[model samples]
Target: MAFDVSVIIPVYQRQELAVSALRSVLEQKGVTFEVIVVDDGSPDPFVLPADLADNDRIRLLRQPNAGAAAARNTGVRATSADWIAFLDSDDLWLPGKLAGQLAFARDGLLKGWPHLTAVMCGFTQIDLPSGSRRHRIPVESWNAAELAAGCWFGPGSTALIPRNAFEQAGLFDETLMRLEDLDWFMRVGLLGGGVATWPELAVTVRVGGRPSVKMLDDAVGRMRAKWLEGGRVDGDTRRNLAAYLALEQASARRHAGRWLGFLGCMTRSLLLRPRLRVPLRRWWTEDPAAAPQ
Candidate 1:
């Protein structure tokens, strides 16, 4: 039997968390979906529970540590489902997540919006150790400018994308260890279909385990180069993106306790776009310890 959705999970060195994520997918209601777990050659092998080990709906594939982007691409190639949903191994879907997204798609199709390529929903960010919910990311649609500014989709787990969107936008960039979602979403935003948002919390993202400052800066730099290549972005958008990336670099430096580097980045960012001076000043004045991790 054909499934309505294929859930792709890219896991690396997190067996227990992957199991928890898989259980969450299995608990989804009102949707016929299959789970594909692509293990990116984690040193510690993922050992499935006995019940799931024998389950036909769930399949696990192992590949030599190609990172999340390649693992997700592998899962896409392995699945036959028309709709694709991605869930990070450390994150989870709440009950009715799939059902709600399916309903949203059905309504759009009924209204003659056949070009709807992606649907995203709100999510709650939970503090890892305490498991306490930190905040809810409200679901909202984004235009090209909004997307270019920053990632608004919450997390990969909150999105339900059509197979065609992947075909059109292409897979996530394997080179990026971070902000790959932003890159992919920006491409999708450029496609003119516009992402649809459901305005309901459908996923819970565990906060912590964030990448280091150097990794983030390198990744954002790569993303900036990719976007600016071939004059893909106009002048105003390019400036905005530069300022945004500069601020991201500043944040990374601040997180790493590099006060001088942080101040330099902040100055460069404000110079790129003088309108950001007020916010940059405020940010510089605030205690770095109070900043979001």
Candidate 2:
């Protein structure tokens, strides 16, 4: 069957989580879609759940362990549909996610809006270990300038992008181990049409994993060098990106229980951009006296 959308799921080692993710995709109603599960050379090699093993709508591909970005690009190349949606092996799509995004994209195309590249929706992030949930809604507009400052498009799972956008913006940067979505979206935003976002929650992201400090540092350094010091972006964009990177490092340090490092990053973040006082205070302390004033 010619599918309306192709769902790309990149899996690493979590076989059980991959099964659940695929089930959630199959549960999506009002849309005809195909599921492509790319196994990124898991040590054990992923096998589909028995029930879905013979399902014709799903295809499983295996490749040497490339990052999620490469896996997604492979899936896109194999897709039979014009629209593509990404679902991490650990994430699940909420009901109406595919259908609603499709409708929104079609409407934008009908209206001939040049800035409509992809339709994104809000999502609920669940910290699996803590069982804490946070509902994140996308802002009304997400242009290049806004994306460079921060990643407001939620996660890769929350976007429904057309195939052409990938062709024009280029596929995800395989070199980026983290923040590949942010990097790719930045390019898409530069295409004159920024991403279209809605407030409706559409995906459930299971979080809890933390990257090593060294890994985070490396990623941040790459981002800063590319977007900030490379003379590729505007002055405001550089400042915003620098501030965002500092805050991100601060958050990572806080999560890793590195209080001193956290404080330093927070201070740098504030010094780079005083407008970040609200976030600085929130990250520092809720108490008026304790928080940065």
User: How far in Å is the alpha carbon of 159 misplaced in model 1?
Assistant: 0.8
* Overall lDDT per candidate, in order of appearance: 0.78, 0.80
Q: Which residue runs does candidate 1 get wrong by more than 4 Å?
A: 112-116, 129-132, 271-293
Pairs of residues at least 3 apart in sequence or in different chains that clash in candidate 2: 115-193
TM-score of 2: 0.90
Summing lDDT over every window of 10 consecutive residues in candidate 2, give the lowest-scoring window: 283-292
Return the number of clashes found in candidate 2.
1
Model 1 lDDT per residue over 160-273, tens place: 888888888889899998878878877877776556777676788987765778898888879777887657887656776677778888878887889999999888888887
RMSD of each: 5.0, 5.0
Write one digit per residue (lDDT tens) for candidate 2, span 104-146: 8888878775643788787778888888777766654445666
lDDT of 2 at 210: 87
